[model samples]
Every structure is written in structure tokens, then in C-alpha cells.
Target: MKLKVVLRKAYDYVRYDLKEIAFPSSLPDPPHIKKRRKLTWEERYLVLKEASRLYAASWVRDIGPDLRPNDYKKYDDGEEKPNEVNGATKEKEPSTLEDLAIAARGGMETLKPALQRVYMTRASAYRDALKSFIEGYKEGVQQVMEKKENSGTQGEEDSPKKST
Candidate 1:
């Protein structure tokens, strides 16, 4: 009884509600996808740098005053490696749009709407920009490490050693 009455009411509501609205025979084609403007290398670099700094600041802010800038250095210097000294592998931490938005918010109520708007408006582009920046950064670091190791080996060969 009550169940039948509820089902009938729902069906009537949907049927009447749908009839009141006008729908074209064929739905209009979806809006064409626009080509997004490309960012220059410098612009992308800046975006990545700013994003990193903003995220780091947000982390510190979330932790409150007990944590300081120097304390964050450990995170900056440590990279996840399978063969770490203790054989413990480090886990990679991924950041999301919400995390970025919260960091960019800086706890200001007035900024929330603008932050959300920008995030929604440009999230894809921003994500790609960050991706490129991080890839380039990793490549640079690897090259530097290779160079340092090569120099150290060359120095050892060039230096005189006592023979037993």
C-alpha cells in the first residue's frame, strides 16, 4: 500500500515534470573543444616552482608553528630509493587539486571563491605544467649526479697514491 502509493507518486512527478520541459528533436552538438594556449619554458618553470613552494608552505601551515623551514629540508633532500641504506623503500607522495587549492588558499575566506574558480578553470593546464616541470627537474638532478660521480673518479685517478 504505502510503497505502491509512493511509486505512483514518483512516476507521476517524473512524467509531468518531463512533459513541462521543451526538448529539441536532436540535442545541440556539444561546444567544440578550444585549443589551450601553450606556456613557454620559463612560464612553466615558474609555475612549477611556485606550485612546489605553495605546497611546502601549506604542509608547514597544516603542521602548525612547531615545524620550521629547516625541518622541511629532510624531505627536500630525500628521494625514494629501493636500495636505501637501511633497505627501506621510500613511498612517493602524490598531491591532488584539493591540496593545491588549500595551499593556495592561505586560510583567507575572501580567497576561497577565486581559488576554487581558478582551480576549476585551469586545473588541467596547471597539472601538465607541473608534470613537465618535475620531469625536467628530475633529469637535471640525474645529470648533475652523473657529473659529480665522474669528477670524483677522475680526481682519484689523477691523485698520487702510495703503493704497498
Candidate 2:
């Protein structure tokens, strides 16, 4: 009696599988994915500002701490005199992103190469993180499918038999 029940269930499963294989178009359409909203100008600026600060901090760390602007003294009568610009001194070491930007005086051209390298490194890291996340998601879906199949088989076995 148990063997008959098992055979009947197996046949039913095979028939269902065959039907699905023959009628692939019967499958429902995938869920619609919402489009991501674009970032506003303020949001873009904030993101850029934060990235610049982080990059600056990392660059400062890699290079030594001595990021102070050079101060050359001018001699009028062979006597050394401290260089001054409108009664202001340029002796402060760059300890903040704004200060670093000011100290760079050479403008964007000078920092282009370093910025490109940093961007490439960050992009690679982001790709790796995204790949790992996708792999994990696939594994989770496979596990859920396996669980559903097992539960479905168990339910068939546990249910009371119907009399004709």
C-alpha cells in the first residue's frame, strides 16, 4: 500500500514537471524593479566633499606629516627677514581637508594622477563587494528552494490518504 502511494506521488511529480517544461510561457512574469532616484545637487556635493576628505586623510597618512607650505625669507640688505604676505604668516601645517586643498597650490593637474589611482582602487573594491553579495544571494535562494522541496515531499507523506 505504501509502495503504491509512493509510486502515485512520483508519477504526479513527473507529470507536473513535464507540463512545466512543455509550457514555459505559463510561468508568471518577474516582479518589477523600481528605478533608483537620482541624487540632488546638494546630495552630490556632500558625497563629493566626504570622499575628498577621506582621500585627503589617506594621502596625508601615506605621505609624511610635514605638509606645511614652504616659507622663504627675503633679504634686503643681506639680512634675513621673515616672509610675510599681507601681514599673514604661512607656517600652519595642513591638518584639515580645506588646508590641504589650499596647500596643494599646484591645482588639479598636479593631483590628477593620484586621484585616478585612488578612484581605480575604490572601484575595484566596490566590484569585489558587489560580487560577493550577489554570490551570497544566489546561495540563499538555492537553500530556500531546497527547503521548500523537502517540506513539500514530507507534507505529501504525512497527509491522510483519500478514499475513492
RMSD of each: 27.1, 28.4
TM-score of 1: 0.28
Which 10 consecutive positions of candidate 1 have the poorest summed lDDT?
80-89
TM-score of 2: 0.36
Clash pairs detected, candidate 2: none
Would you list the C-alpha lDDT of every candidate in the order shown? 0.72, 0.72
Task: Kindly list the per-residue Cα lDDT of model 2 for residues 57-113, writing each as its tens digit.
Answer: 766533323333343433587653543233443466544455446546767875665
Worst 10 residues of 2 by lDDT: 61-70
Model 1, 19-119: lDDT tens per residue? 65654256655689676789999999999998887777776535533345544433334664332455335545544565556656676664676567667
Estimate the TM-score of every prediction: 0.28, 0.36
What is the alpha-carbon lDDT for the whole of candidate 1?
Answer: 0.72
Against the hidden true structure, what lDDT does model 2 obtain? 0.72
> Residue 153 deviation, candidate 1, in Å?
0.9
